[model samples]
Target: MDGNATIGHGPDRHPAAWNPARTREEKEEQGRRKEERSPMPPVTIMELLEKCKEKTALCDAREAAHRIKNDGDLVLIDVREPGEFEENPVPGAVNIPRGFLEFKICETCPEDHAPILLHCRTGGRAVLAAKTLAEMGYRNVAAYQGTVDELLAALE
Candidate 1:
């Protein structure tokens, strides 16, 4: 079709004729306006966490501590940032930030049957991380679904 030809109807039901050679900024502005006209509904953190939890296993701090004490092969991974881990570290727990988990997990825990326990400041990141590991084909993985303080207290 020609540059001036109407392609289809836009959100306003008007014949929309977007220039094929439109600048990037012009296309971005048009997309922003369209999104503003019909914004998507928000997804809450709790909702997302619950969904992730369903797809992965969950272990409380006390259970994790007990397993660590008994199971010599269990790998406890703290999925918090370096600064947070440095400030309040969990003994015997390795620091693998959530952002780097996918890249670093294989080297840290190669055996698929090895038990993995993931934790963060809150339950959200841990569960999400667990779900990711599960999807990555880890056989035994669990997220400590509690606050860091609770985990520390239980560990002690």
Candidate 2:
């Protein structure tokens, strides 16, 4: 039976709007539109990192480490995946995976204007994460250019 075939139900009870299935012509039109749609340009991690470097603040690992240690107000975030973060954690950094950083950032740092720093397994992910934060209207966003291990080494 068709989705629009609601037995013993009037239009008011089971309106056409409630039908989930598309008509054959509608499905064909949708297929045509899908075929005509242009593909999205490929975006590599390196390309995203370059765009982030152009738009966001670039902080050396040593400088970021120094500021994080010396300053009390800066919010440091580790944007690596959970497994990687659990394996080796940054002492003062909060764990927010890169995928969820934008969604969870407000909860972690309520003030958009607050000083925030980001890092990941390497500089690439940090750059992208920092870019996302900056796009979200965060005032002071810094991306450390190295992994957590490298940042720690620089801090030493």
Candidate 3:
């Protein structure tokens, strides 16, 4: 884990390199080859965010609040940092930072089939969190692209 630490068995452990012993020139060549081999990703985070958002079940602020209020099987997750949650927490949401969501989701809600609604400061992180949960075999998931505060504000 040092500055020059490589993983497999070579000098280049920068994560993208396949062979560690390859020199810089060789590594650059290898990287180019890898790029040619694999398809490229979206140009920006917005594109990825859009994709994640499209793959999920969406709920506006009202629907999300209603679901949390009435659905016993629903779990509302606030994917914000501790400081953000403490400032003005979502009514029924459990604070789980986006970084730890993949690791902590199962422990927080073991019922895979139950609906889990995810939201963050804005819409982007919720889509991402929902996507991650879906990828991890969660059956029922929803992403409130609008934050809980947005919903509450509309009510007022």
Candidate 4:
């Protein structure tokens, strides 16, 4: 469909004030009302990171390596960019960037009970990813609470 196409009539059709006939003042007022009705309070990134850390399981790089060595079914995920994963790839980890984790996880490990470990450049992204996976119904999930370098060092 064309981005500029509009197909319908009545107030319902022009609902979000996309009618183009509405005054700028009316649009601004609508925006203000929307903001006022927001249910969630603003949260800083640091606060969110801490909350994720608390909600998710976290382990050190050495612990992650130990688990991978012992648990053959464990899925190790390097939650970094493609370039980063290419530059310093973990021996057995699959590259799944944090942004695409949700979309691609089912393909990689469909079993909710399968052990999964996530790591990134720093612990922050891994913690967030671990929290997300847990919310997505993954029963066994853990984040490496250290940098990729640290994880690599531990693997050795």
CA lDDT, every prediction?
Answer: 0.86, 0.84, 0.82, 0.89
lDDT over C-alpha atoms for residue 90 of model 1: 85
TM-score of each: 0.73, 0.71, 0.75, 0.77
Residue-level lDDT of model 2, residues 1-156, one tens digit each, is 555654335555655444445566688899888867947656887786687799888888779889888989999999998999899888888999999998899999999889999888877888888888888999899888876788888777
TM-score of 2: 0.71
lDDT of 3: 0.82
Residue pairs that clash (backbone atoms under 3 angstroms), model 4:
none
The candidate maximizing lDDT is 4
What TM value does model 4 have? 0.77
User: Mind giving the per-residue lDDT tens digits that candidate 4 earns over 1-156?
Assistant: 545555577654543436565587788999999999999878999999999988888899889889978899999999999999999898899999999999999999999999999999988889999999999999999999888788888888
Q: Rank the candidate models, highest TM-score first.
A: 4, 3, 1, 2
TM value for model 1 = 0.73
Q: Please write out the lDDT profile of model 3 over residues 1-156, one tens digit for every residue.
A: 555544555554455444445677787999999889888754699888877777889989888778877899789898989998899787778989999998898789998898898888887888898899989889899988676578667444
How well does candidate 4 match the true structure, expressed as C-alpha RMSD? 7.9
State residue 156's C-alpha deviation in candidate 1, in Å.
Answer: 2.3
TM-score head-to-head 2 vs 3, winner: 3
Candidate 1 C-alpha lDDT tens digits along 12-95: 443455454566779899988988988665779888887888888888878877886888988999999999999999889999
Instruction: Candidate 1: list runs displaced more than 4 Å.
Output: 1-42
Q: Which pairs of residues clash in candidate 2, taking residues 3 or more apart in a chain or in different chains? A: none
Off by over 4 Å in 2: 1-41
TM-score top scorer: 4
| Quality of model 2 by C-alpha lDDT | 0.84
